[model samples]
Target: MPSTHNPGSSSPLTSFGRSIWSRREPFHSIEADHESSEQELELQSFQKLVVDLFHDLSAVSADELLSIAWIRKLLDVFVSCLDEFRVLLLKNKAQVSKPPLDHWADEYLDRSLKALDICNATRDGIEKIRTWHKHLEIVMCALESRKRAFSEGQFRRARKALMDLTLEMLDERDSGSVFSHRNWSFGRNNPRKDARRRQHSSGNSSGHSRSHSWSISNSWSAAKQLQSIANNLIAPRGNEIVATNGLAGSVYTMSSVLTFVLSALVAAIPCQDRALSTHFSIPQQYSWEEQKVEVEQELQELASICENFKNGLDPLERQIRQVFRRIMNCRTEGLEILSRANNLE
Candidate 1:
């Protein structure tokens, strides 16, 4: 403290202190810059994560819907996608209904996933999510086009497709989950009756139940197969994974033929029960009462059957008699009237 000014002021310590202050200022600036850079990177990562999550949410197809809850979720997802899409495109100074993603998406993806590297979980997840996003974009575009078609009265094309879609959607909404919980849930499509009979006759050990993880394309194929069956355009194929209603064209045809044959046989043949002409032999005790009841019931039923079978008989008889009587009356009465008129004249 006594020599505070003199020695210290011009000493090496002073120069050292000045040098340290200069270094400290730059280091502090670097630290601030590094913090800012870290924050920017974090923000970019957050934005990309949001986009991916939304992509997963947005990409729902009709085939993906298996239940009412799923359909509802799909609709909600579609709306959300539309909203976000509109916001994004508008922010980018483009039309909301018609996004310019196609022009930019490839480049963006190429650049974005380049940093992610292949064979990484993040890359795989992002690729799947991106595909879903694109699919959702297509559906969203279709929906908008459908609405425009209605507004413009392109009713024939739009109405047909829309109506079919609505019906399919309803079917999906009303159905249970397509996911199989049990091993036998992977049932085959309709087997030929002959093949099934042979299998039953031979043995029940043809194959084991198969399990398949769901994919977007698999779901779509299953849906299309079901629709084909429903529309009866193609018979249900063997080993169909979904809607194993076992509806086969051959079976349907066989059933129809059998029904026709049975009906024809019934119409062409009469009851040939020989016992119908046999005598009723009974014990004396209950003979009279039972016979009387039985005969009366039989007679009543026979009478009813006969009553319904008038066919052309009653009307034909009436018409014939009516014509004869009219002819005879005309001959007799007409002669009398003519005779009376002649006399009066």
Candidate 2:
């Protein structure tokens, strides 16, 4: 049952081999070219996206800067960038788990986790504003300046509400307490249910699971949290870009964006332990850096505006109502974004 081949004789097998050899092309080179092409496309797309985002953000006027509406837009930009970055990771998952990239992904994820605390703190700040808003409502209702003449009792009620609001704000400032000790978060149905869920899911090993009902201690500092996020963040080198097919750059971009957005947020919102000094010096230059100075300017303006608002009761109700709406919208959007982040694998 054995077949033998003659050394000097050409058989049908020899002819078939020649035909197959003739049809063979440089498949390895072709595949390499295709992959290279795809990588370039992905890199350029991400870069363009980042550029566009910053450009749009920087285009805001000075009056709008640090306003509630502007901050809401900033959150929208962040969520969009986050979604795109997630897609990039999914597309290159094979390479994502490999050397260098895996390390970067882990670092980015840790930063994201830290960001969750800031988001929760900011929401608490919003809640505090909401409480302030209620007092403002009381003042507005008591005055009814537009509808009727003011009475002594009405004046007394409005003065009481103003006194209460001032005391509440001052108390928070004196205590440096940004978040309340009651332990709350966005997107939760019930705090008791959340506690039960945490207890039940205790055995699960997922890191993101703990973020659902995250709470901050009384001594927690927003400044320290921001410093922790900005710490050890470095831009990838040119060699790293080549090795990881430019994913390193995207990671750096996302990290920087996250840091900038958070820094600006802490600067604008009323968080506890308000040390508004976070150094953000990346090797690469970004357009968003200019916004830092703008944020600082806004902080100064806020202090002066508060004094002015205290003196002038005519526009106080309108201003408070507008800010309340803006913060509510931002809080709602933030909950949705954080929910998506928690679900990311």
Candidate 3:
């Protein structure tokens, strides 16, 4: 028979191709050709699958309000896809050594690596969100404690806690001093650092500085308002513990002032509505007397002011609730995606 194969050419696939070509057991040249075509088709299918996965990942990552839950969902998908892609790459590595197939494998691998990088970035973003969430929770808990103390008439405890919280917030506002001197020195210790490092550090510092300033301003304002109310309530001789027999008339003045002050405090602290039911604790022995009509009139005005403050907080509270709802929605969506991906796997 005439030679059908080239002997000088060193194509890697040539040997495998020739072996299949020389096969005689029902696998003829036509079958060999079909088999080679099938391998090419499989490679193309795998490449397409990878491309589609990348598109899905990119879409999720590009979302403006990318939450931790969403990122976790994407990371799960990427990890699964990467595992499958790596396996496919290995399977095809030995079976195919041709031009376009090899190129496709290499390209897919590169894209998979890029997806991993995105996964890492998403993880970092999630960590930052977690930190912020933790900080918010701590602030909420502190507010709750202060409210409880005040409601229970632990005036001194409430005042001290509020003052400590305020001072801590103020100290935190001085960002440069919040961290240890050693940590601060580490960043500037190397004068020989590249310009890119300096630029990046400066950019991050400036952004953090702005955020810290805003947070400090809000906290300081809230703290000052709370302190003013506390001072008014605990003023010398203003909040004396009078006898129940004399309380009807003697305590009426302090009680009215306290009622007004407590109402204002409740209005200032948006989360303390449940704790600050009715600010006054008139002794069971005495009833509301006509002698205190003037004090009641002033109390009514203060109540109106408190009502205004509560109304102002409604919009803010609504906005906060909306944000929480959005986060919950993201978490639900992520769980759904993860479940679907798990089913596929």
> Which predicted model would earn the best TM-score?
2
Superposition error at 244 for model 3 (Å): 96
Per-residue lDDT of model 3, residues 205-226, tens digit only: 2211111111122223223433
Kindly report which residue stretches of model 2 are placed more than 4 angstroms away from their true locations once superposed: 1-36, 147-151, 178-215, 275-345
Model 3: runs farther than 4 Å from truth? Answer: 1-65, 94-122, 145-345
- Stretches off by above 4 angstroms in model 1 are 1-65, 94-102, 105-345
lDDT by residue (tens digit), candidate 1, 43-139: 2333333334434433434333222233233234323332332233233322111222222222222222211111111112222223333433333
| Candidate with more favorable, higher TM-score: 1 or 3 | 3
In candidate 2, the residue pairs with backbone N, CA or C atoms under 3 Å apart (3 or more residues apart, or in different chains) clash, namely none
All models: lDDT?
0.28, 0.57, 0.30
From the highest TM-score down, the ranking of the candidates is 2, 3, 1
User: Relative to the unseen true structure, what is the Cα RMSD of model 3?
Assistant: 32.0
All candidates' TM-scores? 0.16, 0.61, 0.27
Q: TM-score: which is higher, 1 or 2?
A: 2
- The number of clashing residue pairs in each candidate reads 1, 0, 0
Top model number, lDDT: 2
Query: Which one wins by lDDT: 1 or 2?
Result: 2
Instruction: Estimate the lDDT of model 1.
Output: 0.28
Candidate 2 structure quality by residue, lDDT tens digits, 141-243: 6655443233567657766786787777777877766454645443433355345435433243233222343566777788998999899887676667667
| Residue 209 alpha-carbon offset, candidate 3, angstroms | 31
